[model samples]
Target: MNMNESFQTLNFLPRGKFKVELVPGVSKTNFLSICYGALTTIGLLTFISYSTNYVLLENLAYERSQIGTIVGNLQVIAEIVLLSIFLPIGLIADKIGRRQVYSFGMLTMGLAYFLYPLATGIAELTVYRVIYAIGMGTATGMLGTVTADYPQNHTRGKMIAVTGILNATGVIIVSLFFARLPKTFADMGFDQITAGKYSMWIVAATCVITAVVVALGLQKGTPTEEQKKIPYLKQIKAGLAEGRKPRIQLVYASAFVARADLVIIGTFLVLWGTMAGKDMGMTTAEAQSAARIVFVTSSMSALVASPIIGYLIDKVDRIKAVSFCMAIAAAGYLSMFFINDVLSPDVKPLFVLLGVGHQCAFFAATTLLGQEAPKMKRGAIVGVFNLAGAAGILISTGIGGKIYDVIGPYAPFVLIGFCNIAVSLFAIYVSKTSPDVKEA
Candidate 1:
């Protein structure tokens, strides 16, 4: 459909009210947005991605990394804080309208970044981190929902991949930016952490600008208070039901479990690398770098893989496709145990395989969610999918952290790989049992 037709037929709005305004798609605002959106994306990523830095540079990798005792707890608490408000924030979006609240998320995450340098102790850092994470949570929850608002699936996978690329690019930004901070702080006669504080300032400034740009660029139909007040759970439940074609269920099961592996790696990889280094003979920086490499590579691949995966889903049996991708991811995680035993000196190259597997699985799973979701209720289905993914992060970061401390560092990935593979097998079994497993 043409852009005008897409706007007019958007069933989420009143039939007569959805108008296609003939306006410049890229205004003076797009020029500003290019910069601001990158910044906002960066700021949100720093808090989420910096944990890897902390893992490599400090507690997990080095004995000096004192934040470990509290880091996992802080992450868990903050994610809870984020997730606790998810369904409600979604309700709030429907009630107050998406642009205003989503813009606030951009602003919220930027503002949240400002607190990173204030860490006097673990307690203070954790509290501040929780606040920062909540802001990112809002962006995380809303971005895809907003993007797919009009439902153009042919390129939808590409858009989703772009989101992941932007997100990973943000990680690279923080990584590169922080990599230079110690030198910058030294030049300015300040401490490293003090200089790092300015990163958030940059992030926050960008968010404010993006919020304004979004306010100007796109037009959404205004909802009457009556339309806005549509009962939250009822609509969400209906959307879930509407979206549950033969394909969506398989996607959810595969995606949720596959995502759990990510949750584990994000939380424990650096810590595990660091722990192994004591005997394996490596430095803290090297260990953390090991983990960071895994994340960067895995995330970067999504930009290329996501859209292709999306196209594949539309053409093939989505259940089998997603199942195969997840099985590969499981093997990636399982292969890690061999790294220390075999590679011993360093194990970064092994991650190329891991990255490929993870990208395929993650994008395939997410692509399926997009395929199965109804045009009218994309928000609710996306919310639930993210919620399930978030649940995986919660379990992995919280419980995984504890396990890393107590059970031996390899414990988390081993568990994640086993669970992922087992689940993929279960999904495949389920797919075979349900003959009609295809998207609407």
Candidate 2:
């Protein structure tokens, strides 16, 4: 059967609002499958972020005073693993099909989850995390690459917006329901350790299921048409050389802070709230549930703002859009300094602001990359973009964790807040000096 004949047009949204224009050979089926993949993959990742603290506290019996450092170290280790593999994975994705790489990543994550709860010590858990890092780096790298691959330049923002909405939806569902699974199981008469294990296993099963869905539903074969013509080494060099452009440099910068913004929220926000809950005499599971409420508040706000941000990105110069996003991110992260209690209802509005900021930064960076990256080298370029992100995670988490223990939970938020402001300033300068070349 002809591949193009087998695929269908995208009809997921109204033509008037979305104005989607898929690249040649991409079908509605491919787009929708990508959307579903976005929903599950991010949901699974968020669940892991929220649930890790529980594993440490409930299963491993790690000291609360030390958790900040431990989680930080674990993330640093993961980032190290990711840093080594991200570029190669991108190069490989260009060589193979996105579906095969993506499916393998999901399966690897499943294996990590299955091993996570079984860890009797931090050492064993670190080994499992290295596995998780490889999977995470691959899946997330493709998510960015494929997102860039599927949409036409004119409609790229809207496409990104759609996926962003799905990403937030995944985070919300996982945060609201799946994050509470350990607590839910405990309420069902299971002990803390047993409850934690069962909850993780359930997530593991979902990872396996998601792997199957991605393998079957996504468009198959290498996205690069010139794969055979271009020498492999030249492809890598071409991807790197694009960084000579000031705008791509800005994209790389945006990616750095953008990823840090995400990790800070995912790793620290919940940890902050959970520790606060414990201080208030709550159980580990109860503390985690309380933390998720705040986390969900941010995700919910991001969900509501997605379409608006997407439309805005498509209408303006993407570099300008990035500046606007970073300004918002700066505001949101800096606001943490004023909040004394993360678990307080009064603080929900601040979280709402934070969520919007996060969504904007992510959307801006991705849409800009999608717009600027050459089609033939998209995978490798996106890989380098993700490498910037991995570096951000390594530095931010590595230091954020230590200060989280020494100074306060708010310290990490403040640190990244300043970084966002720096990028926003850089974007503003780039817009004036080296505006994006208008797409032909």
Judged by lDDT, which candidate is best? 2
Q: Estimate each model's TM-score.
A: 0.76, 0.96
- Total clashing pairs in model 1: 3
Give the range where candidate 2 is weakest over 10 consecutive residues by summed lDDT.
Answer: 1-10
* Per-prediction tally of clashes: 3, 0
In model 2, which residue pairs have backbone atoms overlapping below 3 Å? none
Q: Across residues 375-400, which tens digit of lDDT does each residue of candidate 2 receive?
A: 78788788899999999999999999
Cα lDDT for residue 134, model 2?
Answer: 88
Model 2 misplaced stretches (Cα beyond 4 Å): 1-15, 438-440
* Tens-digit lDDT string for candidate 1 (75-177): 6777677667666666566566656666777777666656555455566666767777667667655554554443355444544454445555665554445
